[model samples]
Target: MAKKLFMFEKPLGMRDTLPFLYELKKQVRSVMAEEIERWGYEFIETPTLEYYETVGAASAIADHRLFKLLDQQGHTLVLRPDMTAPIARVAASRLYEDGNPLRLAYNANVFRAQQREGGRPAEFEQIGVELIGDGTVAADAEVISLMVALLKRVGLDRFSVAVGHIGYVNALFLEILGNEERASVLRRFLYEKNYVGYREHVKSWPLSSIDQKRLLDLLSLRGGTDVIEQAKTLVTSEEGRRAADELAALMAALWTYGVAEAVKLDMALVSHMSYYTGILFDVYAEQVGFPIGNGGRYDDLLAKFSRPAPATGFGLRVDRLVEAIGETDVRGDIECIVFSQERLAEAVELAEAKRAEGKRVVLQHIAGIRDIDAYSQRYRSIVYLLGRGGQ
Candidate 1:
């Protein structure tokens, strides 16, 4: 027989958000949504389940991690792993028109089946915006600036955005390694941030000292705008040069937006999202070990849905953002009226009046509570109406 499960046990990677935490998340979402709306982005939502053949293939998340199931008619379906792909599907099919860029926003829960991990969540909410159909350096700058703006609006002061160009990395790799297979090995090292392993692997290759040194130099490409100039020297191909130019242009545009101060150039930066065709970035908060948010240009994704457009966007992990913002004593402002039966009418009237005045009032019958003192402590203010008129 199978072992019985405990009542409080949740599925692997699942979590419960109690009232206080839920309120915090709600507040964060509210401010973020308002800020996004103020930037002229209209919020849209897509269905939770999508066909495995479509969005699932385009999502770039590992196939093993997708939460897949068969529909009643035997069609394969999956819970969306991220908002970007589904938004791409929607924009391509219905919303997007050629030459008119669409600014769309989403706030929803995405799912990815996790291995038996202790702290990773299988389901979490993402707040993000996608600017579809615009494919300029200015567009890239806008999304990054907006991301910085949203974080600031939500009271996050200590965060940095590291921006990079995949095109540059690819050009440099192809120019050096000469084939995708060799390039793939080094790319994995960079993705895992294993600089030591990257150096060892590059050294192990039967290349000249200069080539190996060039590969090793990719790690030091992190810093401010001058790093972009340093990056230009490492690549000889037109593609590589163009990528450097794009980063320079993006930096200029960001400076125009007054967000260049928060951004740094990382020529070696890469993402697991393989569809990122050009610039990409990750946002880090002071105390968070992982990125609180990330986004980049995915010019090829919308074409997978047959609506070719240049799109860029960012998604903030609500859980991580909340964690970065730290905690507060979220004792809500609530008033409670404890009434005896004789004073029930007065209590109801008071509650209604206070509620009409935008106050949170609870009308409690005194005898119903087992521990009145403990229960009363939950509210900010308490009123006792016992033993008749005006008491």
Candidate 2:
């Protein structure tokens, strides 16, 4: 027998946004868009579905998480898991010039299948910018500084950004573990922030006590500018030292941008996005348990598109950001006009006038509303044009 459908059932990890929440999101989006434009970034959009072999593979999202399908010609396609890879495709194909850096922004919904969780969204919106063609510490500093400016512009007063260099972390791991296979095992623990598991794994390994101590000391490299100095001592490789130097330079640039007070240095910070080759960072707010947004340097991604250039950017989850900002009521501005048949024309005229004056107006017939009193309470003000003379 066919299964019957429930009235209110929605797919797992999908959500509905009601009118109040919609208005709040609209306001937040508007404010952030203006701020991004002020910083010289032009907004662009890409298709929702891209060839699976191209964007889907390069997206850095796991294959199992991608929502894949077949097109009419039997070619595999995917609902974009993230905006960065798709943007890279476009930038490489059409936008990037020989030397000039491109600043592009996007606000769009991306999809990824949810396997183990019910509350996590399978489809969500992301607002982000990608800075392509630049490979300097200054480029890194600009993106981080801009992200901080956007959060502050939207009234986020208390939040922290944890900054780290992927290159440094990888170099340190290889110096100690001696192979990609062994290094990735410990790297997974850092990505998951399971320090206890990491410590136990290190202790169980056959490495010397001194090497184990060095690995354990990596966890403690989280704090202010002094953490950079501590990081330099732990890594003997030139690659590791250079990564530390880049972090130091980034911090100095951030100080000049005046956002250094909001950032912290975490030497062990890592991201699951393997494309990220250099610095990476995550932003967390006071109440949100998960990161509201993240971004990093992906100097290798554009090469997959046949245009090898440096790129870095960040994407903020709109839903998580709304949660971090707290609940707000944005439904009070609308005004309603209730009218009888005799006053229909008058009600129309009044609503149009109010709307022209930049007010939100809703016109309704008296007979249409079953409970006039309850309906009237929904708006900030109600106009009565019930009788022929207008009450």
Candidate 3:
């Protein structure tokens, strides 16, 4: 009878990141956490599994895509597809009652069912921060500056923070359509970056020539501070104007912080965060086609858990960040590798002494002289014979 062969394989959209990549990820995360801490953000953690309803509110996560299961008691649960939702739930349940602006940070693994369009793993790491109870332009500006500093700290010299206003987009759509279903459809199309589909959908509506032009103009808005002025003319609702004003204030604040150069405004950036009600942004690095990080303001997400509080945050995809940083082999300084049989005790003592002095040392038993060269090359080690003395 032939032995059964159980093929080793990863589940679809998942993969095992080997040691080199894992180490690189660790380095990137360490730098990010260190820099974020410097800005006075305290770290927090949440569970990997959340109640299904907690994360299901975000339309970006389809029901089929969520890894859902029933607990032993028959309660529906899911592997959290995104950290923001669980974070919001936390704020509502625990932090909101405090009535203070909480600057919290977190580094955790987030599992998503969909395959990454950039050819990355489905289960990846996210290093994120949430600023709750804060809605001031100063807060937004600080967050953007901190994000830029983090990217620079992680060795990404060339990157852009694409800023947007979800409030502006929602306000404009509602002012024109008055129908929730139509606006929802338009929002989805814009979120997907399907400009062609958006235009086609708007064509069927009874919008005036001016409104039509404004709708298209909203999609066209992208660049720097000048984009804010351009957006002012296109906005027709009070919420739209407020969003534009917020963007202007945020830009001015960024200028004062001396980080304006790192930011780019894009009115069409409809992020997938359903709770986002104000300024939103995503970070993109040069030579990397996808965003390495993204975040925005969510004023009402906490209300679902019965404690309403304004909040904003950004999540850095550590795996993608590791990819952007590329592979870097870490080398260690070799002090000694002792080889001996009869003098094994002496070899061990010598290795211990070196280690006590904060030096790396390796101990091996040698059969004969020929084994020395082979062991040295195999372990990238330096061989020292006990009887022969130092060579």
Model 1 lowest lDDT segment of ten: 1-10
For every candidate structure, what is the RMSD over all alpha carbons to the true structure, in angstroms?
1.7, 1.7, 3.0
- Residues 1-391 of candidate 2: C-alpha lDDT, one tens digit per residue: 2355756788777889888889888888889999999999999989999999999999979999999999999999999999999999999999997758999999999998987867689999889999999999999999999999999988898999999999998999999999999899999999888999999999999999988988999999999899999999999999999999999999999999999999999998987737789999999998898899999999999999999999999999888888889987777599989889998888899999999999999989888899977998898999889877734
| Candidate 2 segments whose C-alpha is farther than 4 A from its true place | 1-7
lDDT of 1 by residue, 207-251 (tens): 989888888898999898899888889899999999999999999
Model 3 per-residue lDDT tens digits across residues 178-257? 87788889899988989999998888778998888888888889999999989988877788999999999999999998
Candidate 3 clashes between residue pairs 3 or more apart in a chain or in different chains: none
| Best-first order by TM-score | 1, 2, 3
Cα-based lDDT for every prediction: 0.91, 0.92, 0.81
After superposing candidate 1 on the true structure, give the runs of residues whose Cα lies further than 4 Å from its correct spot: 1-4
TM-score of each predicted structure versus truth: 0.96, 0.96, 0.89
lDDT of 3 at 170: 88
Best by lDDT: 2
| lDDT at residue 148 of model 3 (Cα atoms) | 84
